[model samples]
Target chain A: EDKVVQSPLSLVVHEGDTVTLNCSYEVTNFRSLLWYKQEKKAPTFLFMLTSSGIEKKSGRLSSILDKKELFSILNITATQTGDSAVYLCARTPNNAGNMLTFGGGTRLMVKP
Target chain B: DAGVTQSPTHLIKTRGQQVTLRCSPISGHKSVSWYQQVLGQGPQFIFQYYEKEERGRGNFPDRFSARQFPNYSSELNVNALLLGDSALYLCASSPGTSNNEQFFGPGTRLTVL
Candidate 1:
């Protein structure tokens, strides 16, 4: 079975602080990894990492994948209250078609 | 263009009851997928349909079934619901089946009593 595990199940930080979330996966055929931010109901797309050592960035958020280690990290710099949400990491296997196997997610709480 | 849309944003059901949730994909999208998100857990893939045909399915029980329409809309039906069936049912749509990112709906919150 394909499995994805995220570290630091929950985190609390004040505004302006920086936080890093981790995700590691074990799958037979890894194709890509994706990150999402969920506030209330739906998760919003963040980044999709396909190649190792290459980083994808957006605003204060950036993510990098390490295919060699089968892990990824999401970094949020200068975190704001609006950044408080669940960060989800998902993996797409080559054989799964388009199905995404997601990690349990890391709950981030940014205090103002 | 509008994002993915789901009908009956919320629902309440009792044990042994059946429920059907609807989803309308984003304009021009041809693939739709269903997921179940239990509290404090990540969303689990249930089914994926493209061109009105079943493309993939997860490990969910036979009680869970889905179908897509010609227009790209879809419906998920769960029969003989148990309390464990209560969760947020999310519908996502993508332009095609290959390597495309999916856009999610607000999700239907189902509570089984």
Candidate 2:
């Protein structure tokens, strides 16, 4: 079974504090890793990491993958209260047509 | 471009009842996938359809089924619903089967009482 594990199931940080979420996966025919932010019911797409070492960034959020180590990390700098949500990490297998195996997710609460 | 849209934001049913959830993918998208997410857990893959054909399915039981229409819209049917079936059913769409970036819908919260 393909499994994705996230660390620090939940976190509470101040508005200005920075946070890093970790995810490790063991999937067959690994293709890529994707990050999403779920605020209410819908999950908004963040970044899709396919190459290792190279980092992908958008505004204050960034992510990097280490395929060699089979792990990935998402960094959110200078967080705001609006950033409070569940961060999800999913892995796509090359053989499973568009199937995304997701982790339990990390709940982040950014205090004002 | 309207993204992916799902119908009936919320639904309630009882055990042994049947329910159907509908989804319309983004314009020009040819692939649609379904997922079920319980509270506090990430969404789990249920099925994938491309060009009105079923391409893949998850480990869900036979009671759960789905089909895509020629217009690229899809419907998920669950029969003999169990209390455990209460979940947020999500629908996603992509331009192609090989694309990993899928646009997700707002999801339908199904409550089985």
Candidate 3:
């Protein structure tokens, strides 16, 4: 079975703080890793990492994947209260369809 | 462009009852996937439909089924619901079945009593 494990299930940080969320996976075939932020009902897309070492960034948020190490990390620099949400990491396998296996996710609470 | 959309934002059902959830993918999208998310847990893949064909299915039991229409809309049906079936059901859509980023719907919150 393909499994994804995320570290620090929950974290609390203040404004302007930097936080790193980790995700490690064990899969037979790896296609890509994706990150999402869930605030209320829906989860918004964040980043998709396919290659190792190269980091994908968007403003204060960035992520990197290490295929050799079978792990990925998402970093938020200078966090704000609005950034508080559940961060999800999912792994897609190399198959006919894009079936995602997701980690339990890290709940982030950014204080004002 | 409009994102993926799901119907019936909330629902309540008793055990042994049946429920059907509907979803409409984004315009021009040909692939749709269904997921179940319990509180405090990541969403679990339920099924994936591409071009109206069943491409992938998760470890869910036979009581759960889904189908994609020609218009790319889909419906998920669950029978003999148990209390454990209560969760948020999410629908996602992509351009194709390949490596594409899926956009999720608001999700349907189902509470089984």
Candidate 4:
């Protein structure tokens, strides 16, 4: 079975404090890794990483994949209260029809 | 353009009742998929429809079924509902085939008593 595991299931930090969320997966045919932010409704896409050692960034949020290690990490710098949400990491296995196998998600709470 | 849209933002029903959830894909999107998200867990794929055809289906019971309209809109119907069937039904849309990014809707929350 394809599995995606996320670490530090829940985290609490103050404003301006940086945080790192981890995601590890084991799949037969690895295609790409996607990151999403879920607030109260649907998840909003953040980035899609398909190559190792290459970093994808959007403002204060950045993520990188390490295919060699079968894991990925999402980093949030200078965090704010607005960053409070559940961060989800999903992997699309080869020939999986683009439907993703998702992790349980990391719930981050940024205190101001 | 508008993002994915789902109808009946919330619904409540009793066990053994049947429920239908609706979704409208984004303009120009041809693929639509459905997922069930129970509280405290990630969404699980239920079905994927493309061009009015069933492209893929997950490990769901026969009680769950869906169909896509000619306009790319879709509906999810669940029969003999159980407490475990109560969850947030999400619909997502993508431009073409199975290799592209997907845009998601706000989801329909169904509660079974």
Candidate that scores best on lDDT: 3
Residue B88 in model 1: shift from native, Å? 0.3
Q: What share of the true interface contacts does candidate 4 keep?
A: 0.48
Q: What total of clashing residue pairs does each candidate reach? A: 0, 0, 0, 0
Candidate 2: tens digits of C-alpha lDDT, residues B75-106: 99999999999999999999988856998999
In Å, residue A104's CA in model 4 sits off its true spot by 0.4
Preferred candidate (DockQ higher): 2 or 4: 2
Which segments of model 4 are wrong by more than 4 Å?
A: none
Evaluated against the true structure, the overall lDDT of model 2 is 0.95
How would you encode candidate 3's per-residue C-alpha lDDT over A1-112 as one tens digit per residue? 9999998999999999999999999989999999999999888999999999999999999999999999999999999999999999999999789978999999999999
RMSD of 3: 0.5
Higher DockQ: candidate 1 or 4?
1
The TM-score obtained for chain B by all candidates, in the order given, is 0.99, 0.98, 0.99, 0.98
- How far residue B110's Cα lies from its native spot in candidate 3, in Å, is 0.3
Clashing pairs in 3: none
What is residue A40's positional error in candidate 3, in angstroms? 0.8
lDDT of 3 at B7: 91
Candidate 3 lDDT for residue A93: 93
Off by over 4 Å in 3: none
All DockQ scores: 0.75, 0.78, 0.91, 0.64
| Residue pairs in clash, model 1 | none
Candidate with more favorable, higher lDDT: 3 or 4: 3
* TM match of model 2 to true structure: 0.98
